[model samples]
Target chain A: MASNTSDLRSPLARARGLGSAKDGTEHWWGQRLSAMALVPLTIWFVFGVIRHLGADYTAFHAWMKSPFSAVMMILTAVVTFHHAHAGLQVVIEDYVHVEWQKLALLIAVKFLSFALAAACVLAVAKIFIGA
Target chain B: MANGSGRPLSPHLQVYKLPLTAILSITHRITGVGLAVGTLLLTWWLVAAAVSPEAFARAQGFIGSGFGLLLMFGWSAALYYHLCNGIRHLVWDAGKSFELSDADRNNRIVLGAAAALTVLTWIVGLAVW
Candidate 1:
């Protein structure tokens, strides 16, 4: 019976494919990709911010309405938020060991980031379209 | 494993000596959080700019203040730090930094580049004004 038990367990475990948490590589890759995307986007963003330094509303509107600035602004928002989501995801996984809390935080981060990214894109679209 | 079997092991952070790489690791995390918060500020500015002249004025007023400028400066520094450190990580990922000396050199490079970038950004910012 003991031999049979061992044999049964071995096959079941092998079949189940139970293993160490293997999802980390995906998160790591995601963070890296987002970081890479942010490099150019961030440089553009910094320049955009600097240009707005002393400008008033009229200047701000004209800047955002420009095609190149509008496109870069949209890219910056999307990439920045995506990168933020990836980073915060890892943070939650690292510190929040409680299963339920970790799940909730992960979901909340995803939802909030998506909402912000979408809002920024829409706002930019509206500006370009004069809506 | 045999000694003090019932007691739990001390946490990782408390147990380890803080090395340069470890410090950079934590700073990477810190700057990431900072960038996330700063992104919200950017979003607010974009929304205001898109909405109306009054809204844009409000954003400009807040951003032009001393405190706002300070926060912006900090955000820019965080962005540059995270960028440099992230590239360091990518290099490490490609299996180039196994040697202790190489790791130390890369750490120094990342730190120095981040500082230089921050200074240059501020210089340009001030020049713009």
Candidate 2:
């Protein structure tokens, strides 16, 4: 590798880590914000599932078809996937050292998270809208 | 080097004993990863329901099976742990509980609460089942 000593940057400037991506802490803030939203969504989801525990197809379907239940399910799906995507990104970046592997995993994570999130919302919408 | 005398260096992670808080910190990340993986199950359930009664039946059969129940148990535990520890993290983000003793105490509290909640959930779940 060639050194760029011709630049006016100081050692401290280079050592200050990867610097900013101009986006700042958007990712960090998104994770926390999604997490906050999930705290209640998850609790509601768990209890709701429990209430319908062992419920037959008709019961479960009817419950899901309810307006409130459908809305909550969609919101939970979106927020949870968003939070999961951000969390997995941090985990991958921490442990995956190979450049190509890291890039591939990041892309896969992003794509899969969004795809699953969309699938979930679509599923709920089908149930809700009776489509 | 300033310490060219070959003196003992500060202990690195491998050389140092991990404290309770350190263990809990890593557990938090692990549970977060597990929950991420668990989302596939959620998607499967939702999609199955949206499909047809037959598809939903298959999904329900798997979930009600022994292996499926085992996976549910694990997912519930992971979810509860991640949720509890996540709240602790949010609190830390607010600049509290940085004290060594307080952090350690809070770790134990988080662990206990997660375990208790998981057991209680399962107990209620079984009753409903």
Which candidate comes out best when scored by TM-score?
Answer: 2
lDDT of 1 at B46: 78
TM-score of each: 0.84, 0.88
Per-model lDDT: 0.84, 0.90
- The collision pairs in model 1 are none
TM-score for chain B of each model, two decimals: 0.86, 0.90
Show where candidate 2 strays beyond 4 Å.
Answer: A1-20, B1-15
- RMSD of candidate 2 to the truth, in angstroms, is 6.3
What are the per-residue Cα lDDT tens digits for candidate 1 across A56-131? 8778778878899889988888888888998899899999999999999999999999998988998888888888
